[model samples]
Target: MIEVYTDGAANGDPGPSGAGIFIKKGKNNYHYAYPLGILSNHEAEFFAVIQALELCRKEFPEEILSFRSDSKLVVDVIEKGFTKNQKFLPLLQKIQEEAAHFSFFFIKWIPEKQNFHADKLSKKAIHLNKS
Candidate 1:
C-alpha cells in the first residue's frame, strides 16, 4: 500500500491557495506542491486530495492508496461519498471519479500536528503563488 499525506493552505479565507502532497512507497518518499490561483481554504483542501489522486493514478495505478489529511471536512465528505454544500459538490464528484481508478482507496483524518510535512509544503506553495 502507498501512503499519501495531503494538505492545502490559503493566505486568506478566499485567497491564493496551494495544495501539498507527500507520498511514501516503501522507503522512497515523494513531495509535491501546486499553486491554485484563488480559492477558499476548503476548496484548496479538496484540491489537494484531487491532486494526490491524480499523481497516484499516473505513478501507482492499481495500487492500494491510504490517504491522510488534516481537514475533517474533506475526509468526511470523501468517506461518506456525499456533500450538500454546493461549492463542494463538484469537488466531491471529481474525487469519487478519481478514486474509482484505484482498486482500493482509503482516506483518514489526522491531527494537524501529525500532518506537519504536508502543512509546510502547502505553506511553501502559498508563497509560490504569484498572484
Candidate 2:
C-alpha cells in the first residue's frame, strides 16, 4: 500500500494557489508541488488530491492508495461522491476519473499538525507562484 499526504494553500481567497503531495512507498518518499495559478482554498484542496491520484496512476498503478488530507471539505465530498457546490463538481469528476486507475483508493481527514510535510510543501508551492 502507498501512503499519500496532500495539502493546498492560497494566499487569499481565489488567489494564487498550489497543491502539495507527499508520497511514501515502502522505504522511499516522493514530493510534488503544483502551482495552481488561482483558485479558492477548497478548490486547491481538491486539486491536491487529484494531483496525487494522477501521480499514482503513472507511478504506482494498481497499488492500494491511502490518502490523507487536512481539508475536511475535500475528504467528505470525495467520500460521499457528491457535492451540491457547482465549483467543486468538475473537480470531483476529475478525481473520480483519476481514482479509477487504482484498484483501491481511500481518503481520510487528518489534523493539520499531523500533515506537516504536505503543509510545508504547499506553503513552498505558494512561494513558487511569485518566482
Mind giving the per-residue lDDT tens digits that candidate 2 earns over 1-131? 99999999998998999999999999999999989889899988999998898889988997899999999999999999999999999999999999988789999999999998999888889889989
TM-score list, all predictions: 0.97, 0.97
What is candidate 2's CA lDDT for residue 87? 93
lDDT of 1 by residue, 1-131 (tens): 99999999999999999999999899999999899879999999999999999999998997899999999999999989898999999999999999999889999999999999899989889989984
Tell me the TM-score of model 2. 0.97
RMSD of 2: 0.8
Off by over 4 Å in 1: none
Q: Global CA lDDT of candidate 2, please?
A: 0.93
> Distance from true position, residue 15, model 2, in Å?
0.8
For each candidate, C-alpha RMSD in Å? 1.0, 0.8
